[model samples]
Target: MMVRSLIDIFSAKAFEIDPLHFQDDDIHMKQALVLKQVKHVLHKLISEDPLESLYMVDIIQRLGIEHHFEEEIEAALQKQHTYLTDFSSNHKLYEVALPFRLLRQRGHYVRAEVFDCLKCNQREFTEKYGEDVKGLLALYEATQLGVEGEDSLAVAGYLSYKLLHAWLTRHKEHHQAMYVANTLQHPLHHGLSRFNDRSIFLSDFKIKNEWKCLEELAEINSCIVRFMNQNEIIQVYEWWKDLGLAKEGEFGRYEPLKWYMWPMACFTDPSFSNQRIELTKSISLVYIIDDIFDVYSTLDQLTLFTHAIRRWELVGTEQLPDFMRTCATAVYDITEDFASKIHQKHGLNPIHTLKKSWVRLLNAFLEEAHWLNSGELPKAQEYLNNGIVSTGVHVVLIHAFFLLADTVTKETIAILDDIPDIIHSVAKILRLSDDLEGAKSKDQNGLDGSYLDCYMNEHQQVSAEDAQSHAAQLISNEWKRLNLQILTPNPFSSSFLIFASMLQEWYL
Candidate 1:
């Protein structure tokens, strides 16, 4: 039935289709046709030469349409993986680095040793590659996937950064300078590709004519996605209004749109609309609860609320203040709703686990409250350990795991229960990054001592600027571990890992 509709749309006279007067059904049909056309191009590219296939895959991914051709991409990468050893020393830096980054992005292990041939006698990249802007960009992007102890990648990263900055300085007015500038700030490996502006790529005159179909598909798909996301924002806004937590003036800033952007950025596809909506709700509650701990509630009230959450019962929450009770009830109902849905759909009961995650989060919040109430500051590592959970990344991801996981096994559940390395890495990165920003603004001093504060407290000689620089380095190191985690074997599903990584990327 869908195929027939698409065929009809395709067979319709081109002149009769009016872009200015598209009905809802016409818009959907046109989108489906464009998607189909792009898939055809994808297949054609896959069957072409390996380099062209790699380029198309990169473009499709950068355009955020890779989800539509997962199997084909896997096959293409598999075919390309066999030829990894075939790259001679004569191959250009761009040729070697592009495949390396693509393979690592897909969780296929490629050794950093492949770039050893590109190094000169001083064990640094040659200055001649500096003129090859594309190669320099590719090398820089590949270095982003470097794991700890990869000294060669570190050197390559430094060299590429210098060259890319020089190139950008000389060609500040060039069409590609914006691309270089954006890449320098947000490396491809650390970016959420789906959230990128598609119009930039669409407007690029340098795109090859053979890939015009893919570009058109990306533009049309972006329009459809934008419309869908707007509708979702409306629906989510309605839900927030109905929840009424925002009515309480004391609840910190009630920016539902800002709260919604995190999940929307992480899950860009329209199919994840439910996850986006529910996660947005959870995030709203997280902010409100955070405010309660940080701004509104007294120590006595927070202690009562924390106990009430740990109990997970309505009978005992009446002793809490009005806003505290409202927040607690909302948290309970939302988790119960999520658990009920998971049980109905996946036949697994997650109430205990879900509630436990919230309890842990509240405990972390309370711990910070205690620190804030007292004049003493925690040690650096001690603060980071608690700040990890207090950042709320774990709670968000825990809720997301059940909502998004296709199959809930004992093994996966156990991994989630134990807090896998990927989740920890993401949470740590967010905690540190948030601290770094808070340090700059000086806003985190009274609310919760940031990692920077703790580090300074420990090392009295370090300047504030130096502490922030060290914190930034710590975030970079965590990214390396995260890259290794994502690229190596793990119990978590690919979707879950991508969601986790993308959440941290959004924070960055």
Candidate 2:
């Protein structure tokens, strides 16, 4: 009895929206004016109410635009740390956690004992303020920076995670619940980059009507910065084209954009544009060589290729398979280019370190390949000890240091050679993250097994879910190791930390 529909019934409505609708025609002028006013407000607060100044910086960071006011933020934090000695005595739990997190994140050495008072009074604080959602959220985010043996911080982390989950379950449809879910999965402390491109930060400011101009200005500035980044990406894309490796070939995957995105995530500042491009090219080469070992090469060919890399010469590739020859020559050529640039700029050639890293990487890859082919699954620890090297973390760090170091000294090289505790932890993190993903997708099981496979095989009674949970625990422990290491004195540059943070972020 129903009439037939005249229109196509399956099509959904389009949801096109302009992000910059808040800005006027003179966007540049408006942005500059807003920036000035925001700075004035910030300065005014610093003198009138220093606590509000710290809170404002925290808000700016949460909004994902603190990079624009790094100097002012740093100066304000320094003042707070210098002048506000007894401030923690009077503040709430959220207030206590906020400054601790902000200062630690920026490399200021705030002691873990700063939270000792809160820990001692935990019983009373929970009874009176347990349901203070804002304080709980702040305390939870702060716990992400927890270190090894920090029992109170660890307890806080667990409790906050549970409370946040419970809150989200009760208010599943709330916008704040969506944010809590996101944070529970990948906390704001480590996953800031993921939110960099989202409009949620902007939306929050717009809805509040405070700092709305600053958020609008951030959008325009981000747009301009993104355009510049696109230009840099194009140059790298052109270089990939020159390598002639992007052509249809069974030997490897052609994903120039994919490679570029990693370095972009690692170091997004415009000053490091060239370094990002160079690192992208090197990582791209790594992927190509990895495919050769993982998917295409015979054991004999892998051995030969390993020897060629060890020899550090293109001539050594004369006896290899054609595919390997392409890879070897390209690796050698690109490495030399990086070494040459460093030599010209810094008067020190890091070619030896670069070559040694590649040799180690190849040896690790060959070991994994041998394990898979021989039908001998290594013990979990045995696989991880070598798998860490195979993660190519040392390779990435060696090249990253050379590019970013203002002055490469002997002590720095020795620290790098020893592989600092933080760097080692980073390797474990990357390897675990990779294996967890590979297990889920059945991707790394082509010729080589994964951490999950090894773990499950080692303990045949363990289910896949249990194995994964175990791996997740290992990753969390390593993050604690890394968090502790970063708090201490180290020889690594700020740029290197930025790179390391990005690597951790990718897995998150």
Q: Which candidate gets the maximum TM-score versus the true structure? A: 1
Candidate 1 positional error at 299, Å? 0.8
For each candidate, give its TM-score against the true structure: 0.91, 0.87
Best by lDDT: 1
| Local accuracy of candidate 1 as per-residue lDDT tens digits, 114-158 | 888776643245456767888998999999989998988888888
Q: Listing every candidate in turn, what is its Cα RMSD in Å to the true structure after a full C-alpha superposition?
A: 6.6, 6.8
lDDT per residue as tens, model 2, 415-479: 77655677788889989988886676674435247888888888989988898899988988888
Indicate the TM-score of model 2: 0.87
Regions more than 4 Å wrong, model 2: 1-34, 82-90, 120-127, 194-198, 201-210, 251-253, 440-448
lDDT of 1 at 358: 91
Clashing pairs in 1: none
Model 1 spans with C-alpha error above 4 angstroms: 1-25, 121-124, 199-205, 443-448
